[model samples]
Target: MPTITEAYVDSLAPNAGAIKNGRDLIKKNSFPVLNESPDATLLFGECNGSGKEPYRCSVDFVNEASPVFRCSCPSRQFPCKHALGLLYARAMGSPFTPAEVPQDIADKRDKAEKREEKKKDAAESEGNAPAAKRKVNKSALVKKFASQLEGLRLLEKLVLQLVQSGLGSVDKKTVQMIEEQAKQLGNHFIPGVQAKLRAFVHTMQTEGDREAIYSQAMEQLLLMHSLVKKGVSYLEKRMENPELPMETGTSLEEQLGHAWQLAELREYGRAQSGAELLQLSFLSYADAARGEYVDAGWWVDLSDGTVRSTRHLRPFRAARALKEEDTVRAVVRTEELFVYPGEVNARVRWETATQREAGEADYSKVKAAAAASYADVVKQVKNIIKNPLADKTPVMLVAFRSIDKTADGLCLRDAQGKLLPVTDLKTNGSATSALIALLDEKDLRDQAALVMFSHRLDDNRLSVQLMSIVTDSRFIRLLY
Candidate 1:
């Protein structure tokens, strides 16, 4: 049986409130374990709730990285308090005699095992199938690649037109043109790029500072054009030689908007041999123009000094409300993150994660491992400018001596007294202003701090977008 730890149980709780309530119940010794048992892969328990019957809670730990929680409680939160309490008790090493597994839990486990067996059998059978089927599949894939190439061509043409016409003169017709091409790209399995196009169009329609907006729009057009060009070239090469190993880390396909199924990614993470497990800290930003929320955060392999970024998106209503008070950071123990295809600080994705309280981040270690100086950041931005598809590169800057509001914009001064201009200060309403107000109240303008932000290279200039600020006492999230 796998040993359960209190930290692991805390990680399973949905929020701080749940963790507190569960711990309170455990402290009070109110949840008497009515039944308890552990198999090779699961833990089952019945805990007395505030009702006649106890709440039956079962934890499926067959896949240690992605545990499934089932509870009889009516709470909507995943792993409600009852489940947490049960786990907390087990983690505390409460003495309980083993009991026979309940029929319902046994049946569920059996069904899941059978499904796994069937999947294995099917995979083995397919692997042994005739060569004719494999040839047909390869032919189909080639045709699909051809269609994607065509879509890329269409997108490239649209981007060229946008550039020639000028963003300042963009109107409904120009928006329609981009939208049509975006639809085509979507159909070609490039929803990532399609989403970018739609976001560009949305920005064009929305009222904003016309000059700044136009410049940003032009920057986006150039980036999309580069992405399409590279995508087409990649497809052409794949078409020419099918056996060539495709780049795996955040791939061009993902940057072009390919959606990764969480389930599939999780399974891949589990099956990956000799992959390291690392804990990550998560922060989210709302993209109002795209009607989506982007989770932007980092993970560190404490053993190897390997730092990588993890990002995910969710539509407006579908996004979860991140509680400011609760420790919303995810603790990823079982899942291994795979970085996007190309190098230069690629984005990462994982199968799944469990929320946990994040302790104070080790600013010194993270800075030594991942933080870049202002000069290095600018150099990196220049490199990305050479390849426009590498937009919004994640950057961490440490020991920023001061942040001051200038007539032009916000400027962050590094320890060496170099300044970087900050833009896109606000994403969610008034967050930037709120942060400024907090800084004023706390008198932190001259204090040293760590800034977690992204840099966008556009129109031969680098613009820093503020995402979060970490002070000694707290983490201030500027984008939510």
Candidate 2:
């Protein structure tokens, strides 16, 4: 028998708003628990909802770390507010007298256990299968390497052209050329690279200011240069030693935008520990011509402090339908995460989750994990100057004292009077306005505010893209 903690339960919430709503239910005593029991590996409770009868809610903690939640509430949110309140009560350490397990709950738990056992049996059988079926096809492998080599050549050529012509010459025609090259790379089975190129083109097309766009373009170009160089070297090594043992997917493929299968990644993640859901965000990229919308989710490993991300893309019109719950932060179990293949900080997907007790949001802890000084961040960025992918490097500035409005744009200053210029303010006008309003309302010139941002190096100057602003009483996410 294992106990559920507040933090583990909170990890099940879809977003901060859900947790708040669930808390309201508890505070209002809206769903009074009628019958409560904690058995060997299960917790059951019946709570009065809006309906005539109480809503039956139960959490199966047989898995201990990753519990299963079920509730009769009609709410569309998984686990529903009723379920959250029920678990919240238990997480608060409310005493539950020992009682006989209800027949219904017993049956459900038995069925779940049987299903898990069957899954284990199937996995064991698969593992015991003949090794001949797992043999690699040398010819296919060679063909893939050759295709990647060709892609590397195309990428190298593209990089050279971008550098020679300069970011100022990047126009619709230039974008078209890059798009065509990206399509060719996709044909070569290197979709990771294709995606990176498409993202770069999208940024260049959407950004309005000529100088700012150039800076971003140069950053993208540098990333492409590094990726191509690394990819070529990796492929050459594989060609030389075809029998080399690679545990995970190659870093070159990931840098080139190769995505791992969700099922496989999930299986791999479940075998390890320390996975926790961290944040969720609704991302949008659009111009007059086209639009893209994505739901991005982040997970962090509590043990090793590794970060992974998952993304769900929707149609352009779907952007308007997104709600705050779609982008909330929570902690989840590692088994619920499916990690993408990468050297470090790989992307991940949410496989399975259940509602349980939740804990308070700790912004300080998150900031600490990602915090770095302006100089340190700049030095790190310089170290990876050859592979300057914007998303890969995130910096969190803790307790900056003031926001200085520069002639060009805004800048943030620390208590020690160090300054960091803010760049990539594109597509975050609302957040920017909100921060400015907070600063004005609070007279925060000398007050502390936390800033989460990323760096962009261009023309020997380091600039930051403000991602989020966190104060003592407020948290505003600026990045989409």
Candidate 3:
């Protein structure tokens, strides 16, 4: 059995809010009773919640791979804060008094085992029945493609008009017209493009430095143009085939506003087996135009050097039902990890995951995976973002001999003394780089850092954002 780690407990949380609430309990010392079974497979705690009576929470890990979370709380959230707090406390090396397994939990486990046995027998009785195949709606795809093409033409025309007329000529009426055209994209089932258009409109709407706004507007137009050009060809080809295989290298469907299913990804040979992932950083933001709150976490594949992301989209309309994602500090081991189509840091999802503590070997692997040279990684990143449709911001781990603040910016020196400038607050619209100043001298030397390559169109410079700094002794994350 593996030891529970901080990352594993974070993974069990429904959302960031739950993790915060759970952490608050530990900080306040609200749990008076923290006990574990003799073998430590079962953990029980009493956490004070809103109600006067404390909530009794039990996490039964009789099955190490898939533990059962049971809590006496009114929250619709599974494995509510109380249960998560208990797991967090355990991971933090909290001392739990040895105790016998509760008889009720033991009985429940017995019933569960019997149910599982029945399920296994029933499944075996089926005797190699083939799985059902889902039908494809070709007509729907065709109509969508046609409508999207029309929408693209309209979008291009709008941009051309705006550009030709110049920003100075744009008035309220013009903005209204642009808004109407952008809204039509929703009808074409390309809400992703629609969101980009809305962002462009927002840039125009905001009262800011005129020159800056113009530059931003141009950048938005360029980004959208990239999508439209490639998207046109992609949709046309898909329309002709109606069953074209999904692209694994680029996010064509995302731009076309298609939500991919796990089955589709697996069928397209995009699923990786026996994957081990560890989170490097987490991010959360509100998508105003889409009325959705998006939370994304970046995780490095311990098996390989590739970094993947897990995104949770909670729409305002479904906020109550959907949970917002948070940080996971544990190593995620899964049988099948579905990879979504995109550029660097492709979105990933898994139906089930088992997490355990990362050992020294694991940490060493991460350090070993870091690119020893800065120039090589930057060259690769530049090549990827050359295309307008390419994902500009991609996380890369780079080994640094030392970090020094120079006249330019926070620069990381390689063995060759080749410096890569980073730690720009405006690089990725984040102030996380400021955290580096708080670090002592020892932590800044002979380590590697995870950086996101961000292209600042305003400066016409490709900036690097330091997401976290990892050393043999510590992994300090600067991003949330």
Candidate 4:
């Protein structure tokens, strides 16, 4: 029963296809040979397949934290559909005959135990010394900084030229020219900036309100311009001190596409232990420009009021190869939480986590963390939005005295009568305002909620999008 929950089963799936296929196997009762070891630590089954012989699968829970999934199917995917189906069969209370552990499974477990024991013996032999620090090649890093600087110069000039020409005049020929320039940025050690350039071209090609498209495209250019300036200065500083370790968590580093390792963040003092978190809202979107699917979640750290995010990006090219993240409908207790670099709502990652259904006490913890006043939140938003390199949309939890419809639009008011208008922004296409309008005004009164503060590019005004509302009895999630 260690990994019997639906959530755990969902987590094992490599992609949505596996979940569907696994569920289909259960519904069709494809497993005529469902057997569980007497101790309940091993589960093995034979699932009927297209072939004459059934595909043999087994899930060994010897190490409950990381169950071993072995299948005889030709598929390269880990925990193939058949293996997942075996787990599903147990979770669903489908009859599994009690039997002794199969010889093959027992042999594999013994081998794994021996390998683990050897690793422990080796560590003990060395007196458990810490891992050596990853060596940095000073010369290569200095050259990379130099290349980045050159890329910044080239991009700065390109952005200026595009601005002068204006978005109105952008055409097919211009896009082709831009495409070639974007590819050239790759050679200069600035793939992050290159992605932005490519995103600009993508925006122009998209069909939408011409003004809206132009607005979005112009925003992208503004960010590129900001990155060019900041990147040049940032790299110049690094170029001066090539021996200096890379900055841990900063907007410039994030924009420059630094793939942060957990160990690296720990080295820079960005890692912490005993962090409790509750997911307030979740959303998934396809990033067309980069050809990746982004599964983003907004979580409230129970320890502090600061909000954090976990983004699991699965590239389109490796859709099946990577494990896709699903919405976590429970509270997560992580052993160590690693924070990524950013000014607000910094991306975060964790290695080990224990999840449980969020209870009322957890909700109270989140409610208590909401900002005291709307004015304070507005001030914070203003400072962050002004910086082009900062995350334009920051998810914040606010304590609202009341929700009302002013002549201007739907607004959430604080106790002091300061009102924050709620509207859909170009960056977040989800229309939370429309959803709010359908609900009774009384239901929105006197509540703590998680809202995304966004700067509308079309009109350049600050706006709020409701993500979730925490009431006295229930947590109402408006977005997922």
Candidate 5:
């Protein structure tokens, strides 16, 4: 399923919740206005902004009949606030409308209707509509793969050029050049490679050690080279045996074939610690929903078990009301001491008795305190990166472009200023391909400088400003 982007939410917000109360309810859920339906769907209702202050429970009409509505209020589940809220929100709409309720909800509604119909058609009882199967075209896929290969080649050549020129020190222009290329490549859906490149470019901006940064770029180049080779090999094999059955004969189910294969690849990649990336779902919950997490605490995991970690309290932003469907619930079980990805280092410490007391006693004061803590963390992270790693590991630097109309594996740059050829590889196999497609279609000349932020698990403190490239100086000028 296509994840909802911020733009999608904003577009729906204007219509789905066009009415005041409806809008309020919609905003409280903080979920996106989904066009696709899940099995059970919740409908909108009136925004009853009553009760204990900011926490307003919207009414909702459930799938059940007798009462028709079920709520989250203390009284009864029959006509809950959640159901009412959903119905109210749906009642008043402008350009927006519920594209489709979830299949589950439809099933319930259908069941309700069946109670009135006595005659059941034999054909309807005997037949079933199968789930739709996703299809892929082999030739078209190969062509797309080939295009991405070209993009990879372009990135490699760019990086080599920098390496050859002996301009080890990266300036703003260099950063922009690399970042823009990477961004373009990101269009290909190769988040793994894009992140590698992004990491290098970001490090370069604040790096005190240019040599390490250069080495990092080189390492990434090598990684791309390896990935492309593997991809090409697989593509060739598939072409050779287009109709070959798997040795394991796991193709009993056609619709799930691709998913199973992808899963296999994911497991193998993880085991190898190869170019890997994680899909991050970012969400913010309203303060009113904090009750769910009042007792939760974090369990920090280190990439390498050797790194020491600690958690300290910091203020967090609380929504005035439960955020609308725009908000997402935290998947992690624990509540963050401050923010999910708290700053590694903080400048304005919040350890003071006054700050702690304010945070515990007043919501507004606590938020301010968290912001201050965030500022400190940003400074600390910068400082940490400035000092070369104690082990003096070589850093990887990368740059690349993308393929057109795709967001899967990236077309990686190779040694010959050509993209690593993936003519034989699957084009829409993974997120990497998607990223590659996206990057290939992007324009980097009008590049946007990377923005750095202090990210907690679920929160990002955006402290830096967005910068753009300037040609004459050939250096990235810090934006205010």
Candidate 6:
């Protein structure tokens, strides 16, 4: 590592905040400069953070690696402070190399200029040198296409059957049928076709005239059928000869899936557990008409994808809760992993668990399981609430006031404070054993703090809440 002098650090004054943040991170944890490119003047760094995934930040060194981009934290300011600090660190004498600017960034800048030039050359035409491109096996694709077509045809038949049964409209049952059919098709191969169909259905709901909507769907289906028929023969012949254009759908899935999967792969469930999530909360102070941004959540890095773990915070220090939104952006390694399921109308369940080790093992007697330590339980609980595994399964009772009144059922409350009575937090059919186990864990016996639970009942409905964990303490243990 080269020694970065105080003089070189002065050059990053424009990005002082970033420099400070990055340096602070280094003081507590090591974030080596990961990569740098001389031509693009870009530098990248990977940070050490608590989560299932690591954090990465990049600075445009040519632009003075002044903390232009950060992927872990929630703040949106460009050149995040972390990036700045890293560049400053590197400038001082880090052993980093400059490489060719990555194509994506370069292409991005190139397209911007190209669009501008189009105004001067309206008739402009250009082509790169022709190269032999790998051909897709049309036969295999046709077979896959035929299978999906059959599934859709079955779905269409099912829809017709519903109509025959005097179904006036596409109701809940019809949608379920459609979803099931879509899921089956999705399992067959094409990944995003189901989502596309769902989107079409949503669009149909917006426009009046159910018949017209059905007609439109029929047309789209026909077009799909026709496209398949036209390409099948050529695809089959090409497959035998091994020469054809690459299939479009596969790339689309790869591009979209890669981003989503990459984010999923990096998520570390244990990081959000314990006191951190319980105590973690945020506030937004905004001066409208100026620029306004709030700290949403943390970011976690998994093996393949990057996830931005965020929480919607009620105005804690501010006058009121400001505007909040969630977005997934693979363009700059930022993502919002859906922790709790049933987010739109239903409650989602998110939980993290950390196991505690029992100190001594009993050799003579059948070895008794060691009780989990309170600290370990608390940690696990935090992560669970922070980044839950599924957004579909709702847990029972998010928070409970006291364990004494077991009959005093926990009520689900909306943001408007409407009380939604629930039969059980764990729901019917499925035993509430898991919920009870988490609640009865001896680790929580000592602290009378707010307890958060994912209340589930028989149906798909779920309720979440933050209850008073302690009768004495002033603090509200955020149940995430």
- Top lDDT prediction, candidate number: 4
Per-model CA lDDT versus the true structure: 0.62, 0.60, 0.82, 0.84, 0.33, 0.39
lDDT of 1 by residue, 344-408 (tens): 44555555544333334543344345343678867765676455665454454444667777797
Q: lDDT tens string, model 2, 52-100?
A: 9988787766676566778887776776766777677777766655666
Q: Better model by lDDT, 2 or 6?
A: 2
Residue 442 of model 4, lDDT score: 61
Q: Which scores greater on lDDT, model 2 or model 4? A: 4
Which of the two candidates, 3 or 4, achieves a greater TM-score against the reference?
4
Cα lDDT tens digits, model 4, 255-275, are 786677776788888899888
The per-residue C-alpha lDDT of model 6 at residue 196 equals 42
RMSD of 5: 21.7
lDDT sort, best first: 4, 3, 1, 2, 6, 5
Which candidate number would show the highest TM-score if scored against the true structure? 4
lDDT tens per residue, model 6, 1-480: 212344334333333354467567656645644577765456666666666565666654333212235456565654455665566556555566565666665675577568758955653442343533445666776676565455545545654554466434667767676667756756545343444445444534555666656655654344334333434443345445554433332223221122223223223221222221111112233322122343343222222212223444333354233433322111111122233222211211133211111111211011111112333433443444443212222222122222332354644332333333323222112222224335443423333322223423225333333322222222222322
RMSD, candidate 6, Å: 22.0
Once model 1 is optimally superposed onto the true structure by TM-score, how far is the C-alpha of residue 276 displaced, in angstroms? 6.7
Indicate the residue-level lDDT of 298 in model 4: 90
After superposing candidate 1 on the true structure, give the runs of residues whose Cα lies further than 4 Å from its correct spot.
Answer: 1-52, 58-68, 73-81, 84-136, 173-178, 259-281, 285-292, 304-306, 315-332, 351-364, 370-373, 397-424, 427-480
In candidate 2, list every pair of residues with a backbone clash.
9-357, 10-357, 10-358, 11-331, 192-256, 192-257, 193-256, 277-332, 309-348
Q: Local error of candidate 2 at 393, Å?
A: 5.1
**Model 6 lDDT vs. the true structure?**
0.39
Q: TM-score, each model?
A: 0.67, 0.63, 0.87, 0.90, 0.31, 0.26
Model 4: runs farther than 4 Å from truth? Answer: 1-3, 37-40, 95-98, 121-134, 437-443, 457-460
The alpha-carbon RMSD values of the candidates against the true structure, listed in the order shown, are 6.6, 6.8, 3.3, 2.7, 21.7, 22.0
